[model samples]
Target: MDDATRIELEAATFRRLVAHLRERTDVQNIDLMNLAGFCRNCLSKWYRAAAEERGLGLDDATAREIIYGMPYAEWKDRYQREASAEQQAAFVEAIRKPDA
Candidate 1:
């Protein structure tokens, strides 16, 4: 409940989420974006932003590698799929939703 404990718990949760996403390669980013309003790339961006806030000098590629558990281009080549029309439409709708 103290600040340090809260930070540790949040960091552990983030690591677990990243690990889960790494294990679930079949879950495409587009599907995540369509369904959840965010994706691995969003997480990568957030990670990079956090690093910048801490003066850690993390770049996009490094942030993406951390999030993807590998080089992003390699992950994309191996696991990423083209979004279906339905998926794209859903993503657009999700983005436009007031609460999203």
Candidate 2:
């Protein structure tokens, strides 16, 4: 594939992933951290970093709004749940690993 086509495909895939995550609000960030080692906040940070690479200024709030489809605080108020002890332990264990 051409470089342009590859970039387009990758962008499309990213959009799909973001859309999926937006729709799956029941899936908490800690769950994502435990299973995939990243979460929506990670995506927001990556998005902000990418904009910086292009000489664009994007703040955390804007990047998170783009990812969450709302202000981060609003999303947290509406959908985020308190992590269970099991989830917190898993997150701690996951981060303690060398590869994680």
Worst 10-residue lDDT window for candidate 2 reads 91-100
Model 1: weakest 10-residue lDDT segment is 91-100
* Clash count of each predicted structure: 0, 0
Q: Please provide, for model 1 over 1-100, each residue's C-alpha lDDT reduced to its tens digit, 9 standing for 90 to 100.
A: 8999999999999999999999999999999888778899999999999889998999999999999999999999999888889988988888888982
Model 2's lDDT to the true fold? 0.98
Show where candidate 2 strays beyond 4 Å. none
For residues 1-100, write the lDDT of model 2, one tens digit per residue. Answer: 9999999999999999999999999999999999999999999999999999999999999999999999999999999999999999999999889972
lDDT at residue 16 of model 2 (Cα atoms): 100
Q: What's the lDDT for all of these models?
A: 0.93, 0.98
Per-candidate TM equals 0.94, 0.98
